[model samples]
Target: MTVDKESDKGPYICNGTQSSDPEYTQSSDEVTLTVAEKPEPELTSDLKGAALTGNSVTLYCTLKLQSAGWKFYWSKDTQSRETETETNHYFIRSVSVSDEGQYRCRAGRGNPVYYTHYSDALWVTVSGESPPVSLIINPSRSQHFTADSLSLSCEEQRDSTGWTVKRYTL
Candidate 1:
């Protein structure tokens, strides 16, 4: 039997009677049937189109009701990516060629483990080429005095932002 809607849930009891003795009748105990709604997770990407190498991207998985005790799962190319996490969002700090694949996500809750339907696949493509970058140092010189004032900046040919300068000192 199929339950079409939530209103179909209710208590049901069966009654039986003996054909030989029309007056004889028996009633079964009442039983209530419960219907739990299945969750369908929604998957979305922060950036559209193909992502460039060295860029960052984030994927979001969410439910309509937003209940508690939900843990999100992420996968790429049908293979599990990260361990279960409480947060609904998955972040990739620096995208690489290996990161390109069909991504999907799902959510689960409860002890017995009730899982929502996997969200639609989100295709992620990574460009093998990185934007051209040039480093410029003020007072252009190969060597500088310890007390000399110096400045460094990174310039990218593309309009992309979020670049930072890092240095290692001994």
Candidate 2:
């Protein structure tokens, strides 16, 4: 490495050329660059939908590898990336069928950035009827103690043909 001064007006300039990096052999002055493979982000969601209309869903993107400082970009159904988030979580406030699509994400960091490959696609679907639905849980609530056994049913106000009572505990 060498430092040169053209004049006193210049702040010190690094006139250094060449690198000690063992990754490449600079042949005939044509510098070839190699990029590492992109990491795949893991996608997870709160509800594995067919979720109800008014509920919100948050999708989380995680890197399986031990790397840091990543910004995420998300894509749905197409290759075009949308929604650049510094954090790994993508939040959808209220979902409709229009929001139903396959989603993927990638992670990138650094100035001349290296990006991980797109993650495995996650599918989200929204289900609703023409008149919509209002669900009621039986035995009107006030606050109850934990571990008390409660048998609740999601009584849909309008539809009976395609209704099921399902409960999930986390």
Q: Least accurate stretch of 10 residues (summed lDDT) in model 2?
A: 1-10
Evaluate model 1: give its lDDT.
0.84
**Once superposed on the true structure, which residue ranges of model 1 sit more than 4 Å away at CA?**
1-36, 80-82, 134-170
Query: Candidate 2: which pairs clash?
Result: 38-116, 38-117, 39-116
- Model 2 over residues 76-115: C-alpha lDDT tens digits? 9975757899899998888777888898888889989868
lDDT of 1 by residue, 43-97 (tens): 8998878899998999999899866899999988888554577899999989999
> How does each model score on lDDT?
0.84, 0.72
Which regions of candidate 2 deviate over 4 angstroms? 1-37, 129-170
The model with the greatest TM-score is 1
**What is the Cα root-mean-square deviation between model 1 and the actual structure?**
9.1
